[model samples]
Target: MILTAIVQTKAGTLVVDLPRDRIDLEMKIRSVGIERLSDQIHIIDDEEKSDISVKLFGESDIGRHLSLLFNENYTLFDVNKTMQFVANSVEDIRDDLEMNIIHDQYDTPAELVGDIERMTDEVGQYTETFYFPLVGNMEDDDDGEQYEVGNRYLRYYEYEIRELLQKEQDLDGTNMKDYFYDDDNAQKKMVSCQWDVVDRNNTLYGKVEFRLREPFTAEEKELVRSWCIGQAADGLGEGLEQRPIETEDGDLYVSMWNSGDDYFMYDEDEMNDYLAQQQGGVMTQ
Candidate 1:
């Protein structure tokens, strides 16, 4: 049986033919540049000039095994150096075939596998560094009204999302902004809430809830409540919703307005109920 394959290189393609009968079980198969191709496959002091050698056993399975080994070795050969080697080897092979002679390029299967694996690992690392911090917090300063609180909130949320992605083992180098802003599938899977704080007459008031995206189910609402409590605890030194009273299957909401010296937490339910009672007509339930 004769096994034939084509080796492609920058210069051109060279054909390889292996005779099953003459295959050696232990001898190494090495290639040396023919005289005419010596200029293309440069030799460094003539000692290191030949193409790599591969080993083969006389069996049907050996051809399959050898093909895999050849691919791996060629991929790892310092791609630039390997290209030159392949160009020269192909030239030599073509010359030999024209002269009715045979030639083989040899490489070990293990070496090829190792090179390919290393290249893959390097590429993966590069991708991770490029996409790790999509949205980062801005620095704060005393010269102006720095959005310190808002920046911290964004940082915390980003960290939480990163943790979730890590848990799912999906931390590929993908831009978070693209996923959140551009992709519809991502929009369906992820949720974001924005809080706008307004300063009126030296008093601060804010509203917290989902923006653009809405219909926050009970679970999502509770999650927002917990996140709000966390933010308040970190920024204001206390959890504002610790003893939230249940109203209409939701926690009793509180709105705070704080001046330089006076801070008041409004009982949102009490204010609404008082208004309802004053209007009468069964208080609108």
Candidate 2:
């Protein structure tokens, strides 16, 4: 018999095939590495409060047991307690059974905390131009082969800003590393955020986003606006900025304006027309 076990990691899915024979199972299990069990931790803020979560494979019976173990052993702040509990249970099994389990080795709690703190610092420093990779799977059309795909995307600073402004807390301070690194006080602080997929020419474009912080200045806002418009133009192509160019699908243009305390986004036909005029005329059909 083959016992198939699935584990999620920050990189992607990890599938383990264990034979029913105890000897073979031990041998096979011994091959498990530390890199296959981690998951990406995301922190989201909504209305001045923080929510933390991780993208991972659904739990099984063993996973549930792990959840209990984690709660008892450590504090996984801001994460879905159930998920953390399940993960911790899995770790426990790995340890007790001498099963080969893949997980990162953070020699100390401070080391784990530092890794997360660095991530938070990165999010803050690069408030604009921050990108994350969303992992998935794809099959090759020619060979019927399968492969992992990491679709990169730009995360908008606006999302975090809205979350922090409403909640008055630092979303990044959420304790993601605690659960991920198997440490205490993991749940005392957690953060949550959301991301959307982006496409270009029917192909996945790398995720990108602008990171932002509190008390945004007018200059910063304008810079973001310009950068976004430039990105749109870059994605669409040259001459897209000046005129309403029709692609195979529909008209596309960049519209920017300011409201009482924020900025707005829309497609601008006039801007496209102006661009066309600048080009001497629209592209001939």
Each candidate's TM vs. the true structure? Answer: 0.20, 0.19
Give the per-residue lDDT of model 1 (tens digit) for 121-228: 332321100000112222333342322233334333443433333322211112122223333542343322323342222222343323222234545434434444
Positional deviation of residue 261's Cα in model 1 after best superposition, in angstroms: 18
Candidate 1 C-alpha error for residue 253, in Å: 25
Clash totals, every prediction:
7, 45
- Residue by residue across 1-285, what tens digits does model 2's lDDT show? 112334333334335432123333334323443221121222222213322222223244433222222221232222233232223222213352212112333333344334443444444432323221122333455574645433221122223222322222122232222322222222122121222233322222223233333323545444444544444324322322233322232332221211234222222343335335645775221
True-structure RMSD, every candidate: 23.8, 19.4
